[model samples]
Target: MNDTSTTPEAGAAGSVRPTLAAVARLAGVSNSTASLAFSGTGPVSDATRERVLSAAKELNYAGPDPRARSLRRGRSGIVGVVMEERVGDAFRDPIKIALLDGISDEIAVIDAGLLILTDAGEAAQRIEDAPMDAVVLIGCSPRLDESVAMLRQRGIPLVAIEGDPADDVLTIAQDNREATRVAAQHLADLGHTDVSVVTLSLTRDRARGPLTDERLAAGSSNTTLERLSGVRDVFPDAGGYVTRGSFVEEGRIAGHALLDDPDDRPTAIIAQSDLLAAGVIRAAEEVGLAVPADLSVVGFDGVRVDGLWPYDLTTLVQPAIDKGRAAGVAIVEMLEGGVAHPATFTSVFHLGNTTAAPRAH
Candidate 1:
């Protein structure tokens, strides 16, 4: 049975889609010849190639089946990028966007595609069963151990960006602790002892509120903990609010909480990110306080903040794109059976007009 049965819907609705073997049979060629003709990878005569293509056109065949091709190759050609945040929320941050771009640029060499995945909600199921040749974990997700256990069971290559290092996993790290230490030290040198910090989410649930001792103890966000350690290195007793996410609005909320009381306001604020620093600036304006004049603010990540005019932020500028590219390259190398080493990046301090000596109260 050649499956040549035809129905009334064959003309407009497209016949049950002709297979490559069917095209080969109609072209009077072998199955391998038909494949070679389509792929142009074998030494098929031009006339024979033309005939095979003509038969394919007559039968309305698009090409060889991709699923079949992957089956033969034993690779799904998909690289999973696992993030802890929602896809929509992840793209809102320019840092995430830049990191993704870098990963895409390197993975193109293998002709592989990216499958954006998360470790929460409905997408969690995909983390366990989705077909992936390799995975790149982004940020420090509290569920990292569980994700690693499943992916390791599948024997997929793993590369983590800014994640806590584990056995057989490569981590692309940045100088969060050291960079923030330098930034905080700058404030300390300027005699700004009365300082507070605005930190990123420190728990899996991203609980928002004052950063209490209990919350600090239960924190698992590696990046947040590292940056906080850096701040503590300078101002050991510094305290402030913790945000649910890395957004300007969250920073505004934290800023208000820390700056509302004029009598007990700190002379300086160290925000975990530039966006948060921008929001803190807005909060200061709302409270009729001047930056560097009334309070000095420092930020991390050297990203461009929109509408932050007349004030160059005194912050740590990290190589976000480079970090991403390194992770991508490592993933590519590992997939090719080569050893990939862990990488650490440093952040440079940019002296901007945002920080100055505090005024006498």
Candidate 2:
């Protein structure tokens, strides 16, 4: 008995994956007919489909390649979402989740899926080579110039969520400075003269520590810088810790560092994110300091924080999901040969139970 298997023979150059055209040729059918039979989208006869399947089995053909199909259609049906943080970190943050949901909501109209990519480490390669119809940047990354340049070189449509990217990229702007200013003014009106700020990442490194002069000068994160400027407008001497990311744990760390010292601690702390603010509140509790009584804490990004039952956090409620949807809509419009203008969103200040007048020492 002789073996008739189609395995690659020894001494042969690299084995080529069998193509659908070869299957069609063996089945005695045209390429289009073979494709229709595999996809089950056209009017191919059962007999013809059976023949095509049999030929495919014999040739070890797995069906039409998605890459080839995309090439033929001149569209990948993929929307790439690029962020500066790890994929896990991005999901951990609720604001990030909201933005993603918004983008998904709008892109669903075109039957497209999302491919999340990061600017650091291994995922950087995908940012340059992924087959994306368009891209949405999550925030102002320190490596924005490099990522934008590479994507633009590939001629992919670009949309930024809050980054100050190049002029060509359509930015979905948020009023970070104005909103933070409102929160700061609220603290000021309440007579919070000794105020401090807990900021987000100041650079792509996402380093955690006190905000030194050098760090402030080298800051590249647009959201952090903008919010910092807003707070400074009211409290010129405001200074606080720089967190690694928008996690409650990071905020707690900043909170401990600030609240540990009673003599030098500020009366109020303005956190860049709600999660951070929650952490600050926790730290205040740890040190026997009650929020709005001993320490006034203000947070941004009016997201619902779990386990925050007792305190209503005063914050700036920005339209996170709406911002994401706008970006997705812009990407779809650009892909369909329509113009997509840049969009700006405002944040409304919510008076919660977290902030109050300082008590005399």
Candidate 3:
């Protein structure tokens, strides 16, 4: 049962010998038998294994050491994921969850593990020392540079998902700008010149409210700026409200502000993400406005939101899961000493019920 009565020996100066050896000694078996008793790697008689385990509990041994195993393999078996936002915040979004699920699916086939590293204070420091064979940057944000530099210095293989096409690192890209352009052109074709835009956060601060012109112009995130440019391609004069996070609440806030004043309200609205489009939809509904009837809205990212309100959201669906899987595959390839070409993907336009011809005032 419990080996609380066993005494531990001084292993090597500061370190103490674990209870494994003691368990073997007490059980009157060889040290290798004791190891097998704990590791379950080899056959051990029922009576012999039970005694070894009993001695372990008395000695307070937590079990086989992870550090020792990692050192032996020269690998941590952990894939570091560097995200632009806080770790908790990143996981909170369904988009991030789905992408991570895809990554997990791939890594599971290889028996690897995922480790999340946020671009925060001490956690940033850990990036340099943490044992990881490879790393994947979730998005291209200015905040990622320092971490990327650390990973590179360690000679770690790096893969960036939905990030810039950098020289040293492998990239998995989406047609963010081009896809947005396609979305914008759809509205333009519908004769909606009075179109306005609701955009995602341009910086890590991600202030959860309306975005000012200065912030929009100064955004450090590549995707935000690129998507905004896509909108401008069709409506050069169309102005917009920037949102801090891509959450539905942020979209709702932006939508309310853009649609509040009838005199200034645009005939159409373009949201950078599907969640934002849904928020714009909610805002319109709150004001007793009709979709495509009173106000038209179009969104990007064709991610199927379960139980959508009405007309399917007119948006561009990018392969977010594929983007993640590509990054994981590239990291594994690089770690295995193989060269992998960067992956670039384009988005497809889905004309849903949320967008249509602008209503005559």
Candidate 4:
């Protein structure tokens, strides 16, 4: 407010850098006195404090770094996100991106950074070693046991989204089995007597091959298993092809493998991801088939698509982003010693443009 006291150099640099001495000199006091005025850790008249702040403004100075205050408070002020996928890929997916955004909002109250810990394309072993005040597992990663063990051992707070066996870990859960079962029943109701599935992979090995019962029994990803169980609940004999990840390419590959042989093909297909469903749709086109008319397609994770063809995906619209944000809140609460337990989230069924009755032909 004091134009006469203000110097033009304050705006010259990109950022204002006012020293304690500068604030003190302007306030007509010693540097220590100015420091005391700013910190309030030492006694200072209210009027003196106001004067020092005014001098800081005349020099266009921002108050002391919050980082310094946080450091002195003995808080690491960091929340770690442990995802098995690449950061770029994770951000690209709308579901994961939304979740991260939500988590950021929750962590803001604590003034914490969301540190992303990727195994650098490694496995669960590396997940444990990340420097974090707490850990949130983003999606269904392959190394749950090792990852969980490490986090628990270090006494780092932990939360998982769609993790296995419904353990005591803080989790945002989904009705994966029940949700997929709804989708499967929809297909069966459509008179899809012979239906098959395109499933997300069960292991980190990520092999592109037909799914075997043995592997299914030992499957690690809880989401994958629950979805598979849902399918089996309807068409007990339904066949499926499992791939390494929940990407479009994997769905396309699984789609081609499942749909290429017309004589043996099922009239309906359930892909566990929107990307995979898109891929499966692509595979159908390459074989000269019409969506819903020749083949009915359904996918999970009600996501949006721009360049996808033929139809909007029929799917279960799970709140992926909300799940991530909830995990962040849980972690922060646990770290702050406020909350004492984990969280579980659920998904809803969303019917879109992708499913139809099997052609009587």
Superior candidate under lDDT, 1 versus 3: 1
* Clashes, model 1: 0
TM-scores of the candidates are 0.81, 0.81, 0.79, 0.76
What is candidate 2's TM-score against the reference? 0.81
Name the lDDT value of residue 175 in candidate 4: 85
Ranking by TM-score: 2, 1, 3, 4
- Whole-model Cα lDDT of every candidate shown, in order: 0.82, 0.84, 0.73, 0.73
Task: Put down candidate 2 lDDT per residue, 1-361, tens digits, no spaces.
Answer: 7433334321134375665556656788754456556655344689999999998788776664447649777887677888888877886888887887688667655546567788887778878998788899988564668878988999999999997788778899999999999999999899889999899999888898998889999888989999999999999888899999899999999999998988889999999999999999999999999888999999999999998879999999999999988998899899889989898999999999999999887
Q: Candidate 4 — which residues are off by over 4 angstroms?
A: 1-70, 120-126, 140-142
In candidate 2, stretches whose alpha carbon ends up further than 4 angstroms from where it belongs are 1-72
* Poorest 10 consecutive residues by lDDT, candidate 3: 5-14
Q: Could you tell me how far off, in angstroms, the CA of residue 177 lies in candidate 1 after the best superposition? A: 0.5
RMSD of each: 13.0, 13.2, 12.0, 12.1
**Residues 1-361, model 3: lDDT tens digits:** 7664334442334265554445555666654455545544334578887887776665555455446648876666567777767765664466776666556555533334566776678877877887777887887675567667877888888888875535677778778888988988988888888888898887777865555678876788888888888888888877878887777878889989998987778888889888888888889888888998888888887776654666688888888777777776776777667777787888888877777788865
Of candidates 4 and 1, the better by lDDT: 1
Better of 2 and 4 by lDDT: 2
Candidate with more favorable, higher lDDT: 2 or 3 = 2
Instruction: Give me the displacement of residue 249 in model 3, in angstroms.
Output: 1.0
